[model samples]
Target: MNSNHLLLEEPIRMASILEPSRPSYFPSMTKIVGTLGPKSRSVEVISRCLMAGMSVARFDFTWGDAEFHQETLENLKLAIKKTKKLCAVMLDTTGPELLVVNKSDQPIPLEADSFVVLTPDQEKEASSNLLPINFSGLAKAVKSGDTIFLGQYLFTGSETTSVWLEVSEVKGDDVVCLIKNSAVLAGTLYTLHVSQVHIDLPTLNDKDKEVISTWGVKNNVDFLSLSHTRSGQDIREAREYLSKLGDLSQTQIFAKIENVEGLVNFDEILQEADGIILARGNLGIDLPPEKVFLFQKAAVYKCNMAGKPAVVTRVVDSMTDNLRPTRAEATDVANAVLDGADAILLGAETMRGLYPVESISIVGKICGESEKVYNQDSYFKKTVKYVGEPMSHMESIASSAVFNFKIT
Candidate 1:
């Protein structure tokens, strides 16, 4: 007998197999989604992105007026026709964005353990930088020790990146907070995370409804990514609005889960959505940094088990400046693919950046390479675990058989 081999002629155990692979071939396996903005609005740039493996163009309704967004949509349609490439359009709504009125001319920069104020008035845009939030009854809702996550653009060019603030005082219409983390914040927006709150905020504001009515349903956009999706009801509300405006089934919803509340209701939320995005920018603030990766994996795995696409956003945020990504960013992209993300988004990385084209080009390469080894049968059997509930007993048996396959 050979020293390194244990010879066995007969098969001893059942080796499970993946279902028939009737895969549709593509230039790349995982899709690349780039935000259409100043850098990528033009036909030339959009065509370039398509050639570089972009499969979706996300129009963020956060900045610019309605006219600007409409123009972006028109330009996108033209670009799609010119390129003759199959691409989907994503209408990313500005859903329930809570912000503190910056009274100061400069953004309120914070240090660890610093004090900040949150007033309840939305109409009073105070210049004091005392941090007056737009959400009504926010002061009464937040108690001492509640986390108010300020989505700071602390990262070089990441839009929805955030830092934590712990509520230290909750007086009438005034909530004082101590900065729990040190962050040089540039943006004034925030997302609230508490064990509970009597929130009066509408899931989609008047502006969001107007946008969805005019652009989303009428334009027949493929994906509508509702930001800050807190529950299944939020998705149902959007669907209702879509139904009123046009054919309800024309658009697919991509729920953006960005907080602990959303995490708690993820299964229900996914039930309503056609797809989902684990938006890590604000999600990082919602959870401790250590836990965000686990949530991302869970969300992606669940989406996979349900046979729905899951996009992992904010993959290479710092690539806005440098052409090359940090080693960690590269690893992050690879992990997203191996963890079964169907797509990854470039928010500020493509929206307005120094190296948008290079960024897309680089990420395409990373995704292509990562997808090649994403879920080989041997690797899946060794490390994969389905957190999602199997639909039936047959599915459970199939899942078990998959993991029980022998190496030999």
Candidate 2:
């Protein structure tokens, strides 16, 4: 994070404004989710989002501490009151994950073909250019052909600009990786994802459990989205914990399909969870970029047939910097509506972007427009009716049948 990163100092609320003269924004079957962060954490911005077309406000536990998120939650409650509109608050739990730390106190920009050492310790070995990772068993886990990503970007940042490291040698705990791609490592913590390696870690960390039992239970959050969901057991474990706390029924579980491991176990996870979020950022790192669109189509189609809420994330990523999105980004949101997504989530685009309200309004308009023209009896829906089994990761989008997707 940059020292100059924007943060809201005080709360300033604005009235919920909806002009009847203009065409109404009744979100078509699909919902819109906006992440609550520094840029959009204010009462006015939240009200703007709700008025613009947001149905759910998400509090990401990955970036901020408990205190920070609690404040956001309180503000969201106020926003809900001001708008007097029905909305859900999603407590996004940071499930089993890994973060790459550069302890050198500065940018460690690596050129292409540079060597970096991966260690599983908090040792200050910045002099040796060691990137400290939290989890263990790294050296023996990844092979030479594995790829690594730099950031945990949900949307906006260039996937090609994201740095990737390829393992070339493994020497005990010091696994040496070669930088296959180069970029300026801007922050202290650079998130990493190893290619072809399934991270064997617990579903929930101690902090996650602590939050669920206290703040989550107290707030009765509408949705609990588990990150890096690997299997059905993970969903069951989270539900068990919530049940123990008497919050299981109150909070609907949303499984995030982030990694290859999650995709391998998608059928079971989807069967156990209440909803699905096709988290495209991590999925891009998990699978090839060429296959991401296919996965999105398959995910939305399956969730629709099952009658579960399917959310398409990372739709307007380009809104992070500019007020207007590129043509491709706009098309992505329209296609998500055509794909029959139950919701579309804004990550960095809303969390840290300059045009949070504009992003939501643009996607909302597109969703409404696309829905008007979407055919009810399509070949894809016929194919979906024909096949009872789940589709593959690379399933063709051309035949992905859009089902009756609704948001309540």
Candidate 3:
């Protein structure tokens, strides 16, 4: 080859070695979604996440009470205004599931095949079958043959049960149930439904609603992510609440698909929601563990068919807590990108992990690489149909600019 050709060939060879050899699923431009928790709610942390390419910040409303939520909302608004970053806030709600907490203040170990009792107490306690769970509606939701999870242990239900245990006999404040043979993280158990699971209902509890409503009005948050969404009515309730404060017409709402009934009523929910979030963590509890993957794929396809943006949330990298993500996890994330997710959510990874920055960097790298070889345009067009339609009309002008630049 000529000397000039040899130089070009060298660059190509270097690139091939430095990057994946085969076609990838990365996109030229990808949107990023992040979760905001204790570690990431501050102005500094918020700036870091945004600088790292976070386009959206998911604010989980489940952890604290109304007062706590108000404080967080205010802090978030101040940070956004100070930084002048173009990031969106996503307000998430806890549905009817009984969310449990480890009184031990850390990850608790549960022996395999051990009998444990769970109760409705907030204090974590030691027991075979009794642990404290908080959802008042939990008794109504769980049926027999349902599996409870605490870490990875699975407890088969002898029958549909809500056997109330004596509060005095309960040793600790909480008991972990291994549900459906899935890895039980810090969560509670409950039956999943798509028809809006009403617990506290549409009204914000006490004065907290006023605080959140104020933030909503001031920031004009880009999206509201409703957790534990059961039906289109849930969407309506949330919308109605937001409407009372202000227009909220520009804001979009996302229905979290994390339950059996939610999946069943997915079509109706989509019609009401501006988008949908595939919350696999809780969905695993609602359905058979093995079916989570199928359900996820189905949800994605359904969302795509409906032309709504779908975000894949939860445990995108759960194992990252102890060690680096396994190859399986990497491939799992890449596969989701290929599946045409508008955004992949980083929950614990960014919220409480050691390698938060690395996590986002890895995601960005993987997504960027994957788009090079993947039919990204096809996926984007199919998924973001609304956005794509407008862009298509403007494509000609952009194409002409490119042609002129090429000539010059």
Give me the candidate number with maximum TM-score.
2
Cα lDDT computed for each candidate against the true fold? 0.74, 0.78, 0.60
Which has the greatest lDDT?
Answer: 2
Tens digits of per-residue lDDT for model 1, 1-408: 763343343222122123332232345678888998877788788777887778888888876666887787788778778878778888888777776555443555566777877777755554323666667677767788887766545223444345567889877878888877665545444444443343567778898888877777667888888988999999998887877776546788889987788899999999998899988877776578899999988888788777789999888878887789999999999889989898989988888877777888888777776665455674444433544443378867876775576342
Candidate 2 on 1-408: residue-level lDDT in tens?
553332332221112123222254566556888898999988888888888888898988877877888888788888889988678889888777677766666766667777888888767554235778876777767887777776535434655446778878888877788877666665665567775577777778888888878778878899998998989999999888888887556689999889888888888999999999998888877889998999888888778777688988887787888889899988889888888888998998899888999988888887877776576667356656665547654454433432324221
Q: Estimate each model's TM-score.
A: 0.80, 0.85, 0.70
RMSD of each: 7.0, 11.5, 8.0
**TM-score for candidate 1, residues paired by index:** 0.80
* Residue 93 displacement in candidate 1 (angstroms): 1.5
Clashing pairs in 1: 103-127, 103-128, 103-129
Cα lDDT for residue 151, candidate 2: 56
Worst 10 residues of 1 by lDDT: 10-19
Candidate 3 lDDT, 215-262, residue by residue in tens: 556657778777667789878887877777675666788888766667
Cα RMSD, model 1: 7.0
